[model samples]
Target chain A: MKMIIQPRDERTQPARIIAGYPQTPLRSPKEPLVKRAPTLSELSGPLEVAKRVKLLGGDIAGQGEKQAIGQLIHLRVRVLDEDGAPVGGAVVEMWQANAAGRYIHPNDDDHAPPDPNFYGAARVVTDESGVFELRTVKPGAYPVPTRDGWWRPPHVHFSVFGRVWLARLVTQMYFPGEPLNAQDRILNAVPDAAARDSLVARYIPPGVEPYNALVFEHQIVLRGRAATPAQP
Target chain B: MMIPTGEATIGPFFPPRYVDAGANDLTVFEGRKAKGEAIEIHGRVMQEDGTALENLIVEIWQADAGGIFRHPADPRHAQADPNFLGWGRAATDAQGNYRFKTIRPGAQEGRAPHINFMVMFSGLMRILKTTMFFEDGKDPVLMAVPAARRSLLIAKGNYEFNIRLRGENETPFFDD
Candidate 1:
């Protein structure tokens, strides 16, 4: 079945080419994005990605006797489609810096210390209700690796593969009220406050089981599947 | 509540743990070869100045040799080749070269067989969605693209599709 996919709302999204972000000027096309009709290629995607990639489970802090260092936090992420319906079996790949705001990658030459107990990468699949939880140390705000005078706010990078190809999303989830978020070029790339606010996770006070970690809940809305034709 | 979430870069420091070794070879999976004509997709990802964009993730999704999508949405998806891994991901090397070992997809009705490429990397604020047609024919979708730039969507010389992030001859991108 062919799908009538929806076009992105450019206003609520970042400009195709953003300024001040040095990479955009070199990476973005000078011409406007081409609009095309949807095809099965865009409607279909790989299934069981988490199975192929292997799920690292919800614990990114590792199984060491000594847990990762820094503020313990639990992140609850729920993925929804454009119609506000849960996306089940979606693969949510998350990677972030450790408590000191340093990544395990060799390229992360930031002055922060990398925690041996934290590799900082996890693949969690949303349950039938489109919910997944992650437990790790709060990533610290670090200076951009580009060595620009800017400090990026504490954020977790997310790569989600929804049920269909059209629903694919690679985005960042920001913490609320972070000082650097105001100046973070990536976060400010989208001029709309409401759109920017959607990137921030809501704070829920720490109190429940595994009570040591504060909880931050975030919701990600992917492009919805096109309307299916009615059956006779 | 229904608003789409904002986009962000995948960052240069792709977690090594996510780089599954030999994930690019989709021609075979689980000790079995897919039933189709195997092909190689080789390409480089460069910046506006032609600087190699290393560690960039290039993911491809395509139909089977029969143009049957393994996705359940396809009415005949059940007929899809079980050994065929419909999609795969590969990270560019130090020199910005990424390769995919897969089969040539069969053309869907009224369309040409092609591979869908989604690129993600640091500084790319949004996901880059594009397609690579095996050969130019009467693909209607390609018709919508500017004629002068349509060749940018076609892979040149033995499936060598280099992706230039910007500048002259920049690859055309689409919104999903």
Candidate 2:
């Protein structure tokens, strides 16, 4: 079979290029290989039923009937494909530390107390319009065991699965106006300031001010540049 | 249209709840066994320094024995196996070893049989995507790879492919 090799466009950077943390050392240099675009065969596959979607709720950190301790926030995300089309039925999974910067997992040895109410994870499927919403508390920043006492800025981790495996994406979402954004190595790894800014969620006002819950809007673009821009 | 968004790592804190009870087994779906030759793909996740990378998550998606995937986008005429989910996700053990129980995927679009893999771990700026081919298959994708590095993409009986994140034996990665 004959193969046509193409050069990678300079505009879109792969994740490995921008992942500049100590844990993830840079990859060794090698000849650039053509990334075969997804063929119809690759597109044909079963979309896993949204079994994890049952965990979706406004209170990720909170247990049944127990609200987590922290500032209340509402998060809304839209999933889109490379064509700038809404990708309905895609799964969006998110995990984050509690307001105190503590995770409920065993590996998280951080001294901060794990909020008993916070489950720390939620999974939901985008609706027909490609949107998923969750009500949760703002997470806190915590120190990591990297060199120089590296502290991870408050952020939410996201895993998105589109129609096929080729569209899978995993990234972190940051809050806008955080002072630590300037110093975070991971966020800074992306050379493009606009791309990095897309990771920050924008605050939106809720209709009822008395409710006092913070609202943030963010969107995830699945594939190529033709898809909706990462951040608008 | 906007530029494609950059990738990010799946940090160390992936919740345990993400793993479903039978996520590692693709053959067994709702008590009905998928039709095909059941095989196991096993390997370890290692860093460039040769240290074991435990707790990493690996997910695989492929076609069924009939060369049909369960996905809605597949335009092929092949019939998808009702009993096959065609997708599975597993995490590496303390020793960085991971395994998946699945059938040999059939060929599609004149291409050789292969399975797609996505690797995620803390510190990964984005998930790593790669494909695994059976040693016996005459896949052009495998043939196009350098002769010396082709072994890194092939799985023999019992199927083992140790992933080296970077370094001398850094596994070849693909663009989306």
Candidate 3:
């Protein structure tokens, strides 16, 4: 049987396009009506220290005998709540293709050879300081079939499971100064350029101490419009 | 008062590598049966155009039969069922079909029996959040929704729910 759903309540609705870009042409014209739930945010709750501890400090991508055959990078990030308080114990999961633009999964039929050393997945918990770090090689750009073969910019897929479902976020971290960011439709789906820019990670120059890898800092704000816009 | 975070698609190519062996069954823990009525929840992940959205990830979290969430934030004094995981994940098959073996979640303050859903797939810019309620419940949120559309949120007999990404009869998604 069919049901005529009501329009979403404005008070509970997020900002359209900018806050929750539907990704037009890509979004379903028959997409379901949005229902605003006052209890939705309560679905997530504080994770246990035991569960949190199990996820801390695991290499996500660089697991090969060699350094994974790409530019070495040291990525650091801080997780924060809406009130600007550091959120400890949140699980940060990351997965991505290797430096050769190939994932270590059977479904990735791109024919790009997977690096044996690159595990391609990692998990960590935000420490008491709300900071987490990962040592990995830069992922290469990969192509997906869109109109005439769309090439996804170099990016790492991130999934943050915060204390509450309201804080749960899944997004891609793009490299700063990547020319393809301008041409990519997924990145451009976000109407606000400033908000879109929040997805890019910036390079930090290696200090004189001679660290072997390039560093990038990307902070994840769980539920806020401040520095990092919350993912819809 | 905090603005909700935006979402991004989980992308295509999320292989079975991420699937934990027992992720699709919430009624069992370490081979022990959970302490609730076992029910089957089945649905299809379809696009607005009635096409199946294969390979999409569907994850669900809900409170146990005692109305207590497995999460630490549950304020109610209910005890959690040791054998109930209260969470499950499944990927849509070639036909965009997914199913879960779970229990009927109990009601809690300001809410009725329901299951929370998170959908992730390629083409989607971000994950979509929604809830499924039993037709028998009297949830204020469900009641507030228009009568005709309320059926969209209610699971029918046989516990079947079909998720439409867009188009006519689109499922009701939440901004929460």
Return the TM-score for candidate 1, rounded to 2 decimals: 0.95
lDDT to native, each model: 0.84, 0.74, 0.69
Residue B48's lDDT within candidate 1 is: 91
Ranking by DockQ: 1, 2, 3
How well does candidate 3 score on lDDT at residue B11?
Answer: 72
lDDT of 1 by residue, B35-68 (tens): 9999999999998998998889999999989998
Q: Model 3 chain A — which ten-residue stretch has the worst lDDT?
A: A1-10
- Candidate achieving higher TM-score, 1 or 3: 1
lDDT of 1 by residue, A1-232 (tens): 3434577677678765666677788887777777887776787788767645767789976555868888888998999887777788899999988888899998887598878888888988999889999998888989875676788889999999977887789999999879888898888888788998999999997676668778899999987644763344
Interface C-alpha RMSD after superposing true interface residues, each candidate, one decimal: 1.9, 4.5, 7.2
lDDT of 3 by residue, A72-174 (tens): 8888887776555677777787887889899877668665777777777777788887888888889988876443556788998888877665556887788
Residue A80 error, candidate 1, Å:
0.7
Better of 1 and 3 by DockQ: 1
What would the per-residue lDDT of candidate 3 be over residues B23-136, giving only the tens digit for each residue? 778888656888878899999988766788777888788878877776654655247786676767788888989999998888877788888888877767656777889864
Candidate 2 per-residue C-alpha lDDT over A26-101 given as tens digits, one digit per residue, 9 for 90 to 100:
4322445435655544454346656412446545645457989998888888887655667788888899999999
Q: What is the lDDT, from 0 to 100, of the residue B101 in candidate 3?
A: 90
Backbone N/Cα/C clashes per model: 0, 17, 20
TM-score of each: 0.95, 0.89, 0.84
Off by over 4 Å in 1: A1-4, A146-148, A225-232
